[model samples]
Target: MRELGAHAAALAARRPGEVRLRRVGTSRQGAPLLLLSVGHGSRQALVVAGPHANEPVGGATALRLAERALADPRLTEGADATWNLLLCLDPDGSRRNETWLTGPYTLGRYFRHFFRPGFLEQPEWLPEGAAGAVLPETRALLDLQDELRPFLQCSLHGVDVGGAFVELTRDLPGLAQRVAHSAARLGIPRELGPFDTLYWPALGPAVYRVPPPDTGDLAAAITEAAVESTWFHPRPHGTVTAIVEAPMWGVDAVEDPTRPADPDALLRPVGHTLRRDTERLAGILARVRPRLRDTPGAGRLLAPVDDYLLVGPGIADSWDPDAHVPGARALPLLDTARLTALRLAGRRLALRTAGLLHQLVTASGRDPDGVLPELDRLIDAWCADYRVGCGAYWIPVARQVEYQARVVLAAFDLAGRPTRPHPPADRPARHATPRPEPVRRD
Candidate 1:
């Protein structure tokens, strides 16, 4: 964060009047939420990076986008949008994940260093807390949304393992095509299977239509909270929120479109493995809860673990081997099994649990001999399985950053094009009622 802050400061120095850097809000842990405002175009844009703490690929993209906007007028003046970039949204969670941010990027190292916040702790979830209070980070984003009333907002995100895909708040066919072409040119495979946004309506191979704001969907059902970030943004502003994701590790199976000859037989093991892993994780947490419950911030760290333990078994029970996927030409059942195993192996939960315990033991001035090793062993087993099952190959960090930046740039065209405007009803009598701007000359 210090490094990013310094970079932003240096950019402002390079262009004194055009670039403006300001503190929008402070994080729960007291990290400054900095926003870099560049260009003076009439339209407004918000590009958020590191919204998901575990996904650091977007951090690099934010830096690149800022640098690009400073160097090229086309992205800002040409598109007629003053680009406002939030370099990192969840600094507290991002700090915990710094261990694996550097090289020697193996699956084992990645899992060992992984740290994702619980749904409640996340900045993107709505006010699910008592008294309707929100995390400072969430408040920062909401305040910005209200102040800017942007025409475009893009949230940068990435998956641990899979090909590239995108989710859009509104359908923009041109932007989707451009994003897909950029990934293809860079040799990044498009995700062709049911992955994170399985319930989302597909616009193409890698493009998905996100659920409307405040609308009940699979995500809202899971957390019992409306998404407060992209989904909560004012639709009256004609905001097109693009949630873009790239893969850290490229697995060829995720790109496979072959339907299995006997889908049920192929998917049977997935259910069995899910159940087995769920039980294993539950048992691990049960034994460690007594020792770690009182540790500082342990509740915050274990929230996701608790939710996983509660939901994992039920999902396993409901996983039907006989059911057919939406797209008949989706990933083969074997591919589904591989991704599901890696995701449900309790790898993320084990890492977060062990990390918290390590902190507690260290703060007490004692060695970590208690529950850390047990969780470490589970992570090791998960790493071995991932290599064999997923045919794991680490995509270069440069490529992931580039792919995210290209996708956002592609969406510039969508932002530039005028949408049907819906002005607020409470406008003052003296001011002229706003109407959609006529298409501006290049």
Candidate 2:
């Protein structure tokens, strides 16, 4: 976070009037939330990175976009948009995941250092009317959204292992297709099916419409009010919000379009395993609950794991490989494997959360030793699956950044103009880095 801040500061100093760096607010852990604005144009494009602390690609994408905007004024000028970027939205949670940031990018290392806040604690998924619980980082983002009333709000998000995909607040007809095509051109697979946005309305290949705020039973039961984010609110005009996803570790299974002869047989065992593991973890949390009370901030720290235990079983029970949805008679092997990997990833995250909570308990001079051995065993078992098979490989950092940057740029074009946009036949379009002219700050 300090390095990011320093780089932004230096860029601001170098460009003086063109770039503006403002200390927006402080995070829950008291890290400064900085908003960096580049270029002055009629439209406002708000790009939020690190909304989910574990997804680090967005931060790199923000810097890449900044460099592009600084080098080629035409991107901003042509789109008629001022770019407002929050480089790291959740620094407190991000700091927890920093151990693997400079990466060997392996699945074992990634999960070992992973720390994702519960949905309730996330800046983007805070429950409505629970303003009292809003973190400082969320408040800053909310204020910025209201002040800007942006035409385009892109939240940069990613998956643990999968092909690249996207979710939009509303359809900008051809935008998703263009983004997918761009990813394909870059040698990145367009995620075929069964991603996080699987239930949302499909816009095109690898893209889905983000469902209405608080649409499902799970959301209603978990959150006190309708969960909302910059995507739903602050839309004085029609704002096209995009949640762009890439993978930390790309997997071939996510891109495979084949279907097994008995998809259900392939899926049932994994589903049962996930449920059994979730039940076991819940029991462990239940056992350790008494000792956890003495740990300061234990509630905040363990909320994610607790929430998972509360919701995980129900989710697993509802999973059906043969469930019918639009245009599909059976789940493809691609989606079947993707969803399995996705759910297993969630379980691993829950385990990591438990591990962190154990650390806190020990630090507070409380021994939650009864559950420590079990937690270690669970971690080892979960980490083993990801290490072998599952088609997991470390995706180059450059490839992830490039794919996300293209998505952002394409969204900018679609949102800036009223007409339906066409996917470019050429490579991901780039503006020649001409000499930048000094522009007034907004």
Candidate 3:
């Protein structure tokens, strides 16, 4: 919370007209969750919430955008000309991710544990009738959205490993081309599509459906349900709603030809790639600023293009590695290894379920052994199924595993069977492994 406050304060101080720290709500821990509003005009409203904890880039990008918007007056100007930009919706999550934020070279580590709705093992996503309820952070946003009712709402997210970029929207015109053009300018490979076609295919059609009239306050209801529902569903009410999932690291330029398996060698050029991409993204935004202001009903004009372009193949080429080495697999192996470690960690947590139940039985005099076993079985099953489903894709594997772990942990906590850490295992010692010296290039 202190960290979030400090960052927010810094943002406000740096960009007075474009940034304001507004208190949205408090977390269960009573920590204040703030919304950083940038830009100051009545022409159009743009809301971007980030760091949902696991995905910090969104927060970083949002802050960067806010700062940029403040610095550049044209961004605030529109055809009829006025715009409102809200930055950073989840401060609690963002603050919790301070470790990664403060680290010097921890993008890889951060990407590995990248947090998402289901992955944090949070209690907020659990069903009210079945288990726990929504988190204060999510709830606050729901309330805020209802009150503000912005013209455009975007949740910034990024995948650590993947060749494709995804822009999720139910229906938005020209949003696809604009986003793709923006991505191209930024140098990030991207596509625009419905949420269903990429990660949440099952929820795609449903998300596209127009809400029934009685659906009072669409965005708020959808936000509430999203935070509370057991499954991922699209909210019919948001005027222009979508999630942009960018790749945290670059992907192999070549896909068809298999390459030698060398994770280190594969990632050596990522830094250069990202630097180029950042510059391109900045340029893209600059170009789009004028078009956004000039277009009448900019939100509607942007929607259709946003949907189709995001998912289409044309946008996919932006992030492709400039040069391809034929016969290389082009796999995001580093991300794969990190994701595997996370899954193992989640599995290790399951091992403690029995111990947790025993502790509960000892302390509360309630034997939940039978129920614990059943729950354990269910959790194991979920994890196994999740692993299988996500195994084919590095991004999905990490995402789904994180989600399953969160759900399992929340369920266990709600059931009053909290677990404790086990003592470290002893192992036979051998000669110490030597650290590799840094490689130098002439």
Q: Which candidate is the best by TM-score?
A: 2
- lDDT for residue 325 in candidate 2, whole number 0-100: 30
User: Pairing residues by index, what is the TM-score of model 2?
Assistant: 0.84
Clashes of each: 0, 0, 38
| CA lDDT, candidate 1, residue 359 | 47
The numbered model that scores best in lDDT is 2
Candidate 2: where is the Cα deviation over 4 Å?
Answer: 129-133, 215-226, 320-373, 421-442
RMSD over all Cα atoms, model 3: 22.1
RMSD of each: 9.6, 7.0, 22.1
- What's the residue-level lDDT of 30 in candidate 3? 72
lDDT of 2: 0.70
lDDT of 2 by residue, 211-237 (tens): 767744543435222355656775556
TM per model? Answer: 0.83, 0.84, 0.45
The TM-score between candidate 1 and the true structure equals 0.83
lDDT string for model 1 (1-442, tens) is 7888898899899898889999999998899999988999888888898888889887788878888887899877887779899988999999888888875888777766667777667787664422254688888887888789888788988877667888777876555456656766666667754445554566665777776545344334453333434454556677888888888876666666565676666456665666677686677567656667456776766776666666555445445454443433343344543444334333433444444434444444533445556656766776666667666677788888988998998886666676534322122113332232232111
Per-residue alpha-carbon lDDT of model 3 for 25-53, expressed as tens digits? 77656766667776565533444545344
Q: What's the C-alpha lDDT at position 418 in model 1?
A: 60
